[model samples]
Every structure is written in C-alpha cells, then in structure tokens.
Target: MKKTVLVFGLLILALLLMFQFSKYAVISGDLKVELIVASIAIVFFFIGVYINKKTLQKPNTPIEEISHKRIKELDISNREYEVLQKIAEGLSNKEIAQSLFLSESTIKTHVSNLLVKLDAKRRTQAVKKAKSFQIL
Candidate 1:
C-alpha cells in the first residue's frame, strides 16, 4: 500500500538523519575538552574587553537646560519651532510635511521662515543655530 511505503521511507530517512548526527556528535575526548576551553577563553576575553571599555569611558554630563529667554529673543514661532525640530532630526521638507500632515509647500514656507529667523542660509545651518541656542 502507499501508506506502508510512506512509513518505511520516513523510517529510513529518520535513521539516516540519526546516523549523520552521530558522526558529528562523536568528537574525540581531547577535541571536546579543547573546544569547551576555547569557548570559555573567548567568553572571558569579551568580559575583560567590556570591563576595560567601561573603565575608560567618561561619565556622561547632564544635558543643558532649554534657554527660554534666548528662544524668546529669537522670536521663533511655535509652528516654526516644530519645523526646526524636524530639521534638526534631518527630515526633508516633504518628509516633515507628511509627518505633520501638512502640504509640502506649507512645510517649505515653514522651513524658509525658520532659516530667516535662525539667520542661516541652509537647513543644516538652521539646525546648528537652534542646537547652539538649546531651542532644539
């Protein structure tokens, strides 16, 4: 019957798989110990590197507080501030427009206004100015 042949075929495949696996599993005693020792050495090496890196790292300084007074002096509007934040995140005007659900032309106007307010000729300059003022 087809069922009997299928069962025998499956049995033969299972035996072949076990035989192949046994060949890999039957490593020499010395080789097994060497592999375990090598694995342990690799783990310890990584641990030592991690500890060294941690020890060499400088303590992180607290982020500077936002300067509302400077921001007020800059006279940047709330919506323009939102646009500037997007600029700081490196989003293009089209991407910002899609994210804020506004038209691309509207986003372009916002970017143009931001550039004037920030006294920068380009998006990168505007972002730099905003970040320097801590208004980002």
Candidate 2:
C-alpha cells in the first residue's frame, strides 16, 4: 500500500515538472485543451479502478459452503462422478455424451441427477460445487 502511494506521488511530481517546463515554452491554446481532456480521462480511469477494486471481493456464501459439505457426504456413483469431471473440464452435455459414447439424453439425465445431488441450478454450478467438496 505504501509502495503504491509512493509511486503515485512520484508520478504526480513528474507531471508537475512537466507542467512547469511547459510554462517556459510558448504553449498553444489547443495544447491546453488537450491536456485538460487527458487529465480528465486519467482521473476517471483511476476512479473507475478504485471503485472496481472495492467491489471485486469474492463472496463466501454460507449456502455455498453447506452445499459443498452436503455434496461431499454424498456417495456419487463412478459414472456420475465421471460426468462431473467432464463438466469441470467445461464440456457440454452433448460433448460429454460424445466423449463417453452415450446418448445426449442420457448425458442430460446424468447431469440432472448431478445437479439434484449437488443442489445446484446448473451444470457449471454443480461442477464448481463438486470441486469445492473435493469430490471431482
């Protein structure tokens, strides 16, 4: 934190020197307008970064933790666990079906069961929950 502040302070000092040097020269009116626009853009960019930094914290929901624990307690079958692994690798139902030589409908059924077991609304969420539980 201190390092960031020091670096920012140094940057401001450098800009001050640049402005001072520009004063000794014949500055055009258009140049001043350009400088104003550039400064506004820079300030807005930093403000956006600051606001985003404050809001970008990872949310640790109790439901998510409990869901993981419950999933861990579950004795998922080997086939279901394989489907979970493929899902974790970002495979779609049809893709997983193709890879595992099963029908897409069968894959859908397996995924549905996995979602119910994991207490997730989607396959991606199920995969994440499985991972959190160290089950896949």
Candidate 3:
C-alpha cells in the first residue's frame, strides 16, 4: 500500500513538473501549443498501456488432470459421476434428474450411493472429498 502511494505521488509530481515546463515554454514562445498537447497525450498513452499490461494479463496456471484411477477405486459409475458433477454445480436432485433424463428416485439412489462410496455424510462433503481425491 505504501509503495502504491509513493509511486502515485511520484507520478503526480512528474506530471505537475511537465505541465509547469509546458506552461513556461508556451509563455516564452519556445515550444508550439500543438507540441505540448501531443507530448501530454503520449505520456497518458504510455501510462494506460502500462496499467493494462499489469492488471489485465492472465495468469499461466496449468490445468489439473482428473484422477480416473481414483474414480475407479471408488467404484463410481459413469451415471453416478454425472450426478456428482451436477451436484457439485449446485443442482438439486430434481434438477439433476431432469438434466440426466433420469427419475428423481434414481437420482436419490445415485446420491445415496455416492455418499456411501465417498464416505461423506452430506452432498457438499462428497463434492469436497471428490475434489481432494482429484476425481471430480
């Protein structure tokens, strides 16, 4: 925070000095008005470019690979995994059933089986465990 304040303070001071120099040059007829305006515009353009490069660049994070072996070890079926993914997306059992074209009872059964297989007491816990195992 202190560094940011110091940098901004320096920038403001530099801009003030430039403006004062431009004013003196204009009064003394040493520099053209168009030249002073162009110089200020160029400085602002560089400042904008620097800010964009610093704040808008994306971080280079590698994607995590899913653990198919862990899924197999947990004996989670494809359909159950689909249901688990839907649950992780904050979907309710009815919504999962609708999306998967399965009955609500079937969805409930899959959820219960997932709870037992993942040794989780709740849906959130199951999702958390699945993420920890890198199987989701």
Strongest candidate by lDDT: 3
1 versus 2: better lDDT goes to = 1
The residue ranges of model 2 lying beyond 4 angstroms of the native Cα positions read 1-72
Query: Backbone collision count in every prediction?
Result: 0, 0, 0
Worst 10 residues of 1 by lDDT: 22-31
lDDT of each: 0.78, 0.75, 0.94
User: Residue 54 CA error for candidate 1 (Å)?
Assistant: 1.3
Screening candidate 3 with a backbone cut-off below 3 angstroms (N, C-alpha, C), the clashing residue pairs are none
What is the lDDT ranking, best to worst? 3, 1, 2
Stronger candidate by TM-score (1 vs 3): 3
Query: By the TM-score metric, which is better: model 2 or model 3?
Result: 3
Ranking by TM-score: 3, 1, 2
**Would you estimate the TM-scores of all the predictions?**
0.62, 0.48, 0.72
Off by over 4 Å in 1: 1-43, 46-58
lDDT, candidate 3, at 87: 96
Root-mean-square deviation of each candidate, in angstroms? 16.3, 9.4, 3.0
Candidate 2: residue 39 lDDT (0-100): 66
Off by over 4 Å in 3: 1-34
Question: Higher-lDDT candidate among 2 and 3?
Answer: 3
For model 1, how does the per-residue alpha-carbon lDDT over 12-85 read when each residue is reduced to its tens digit? 68556645544555463333655655655675576568657866999999888888888789888778888888
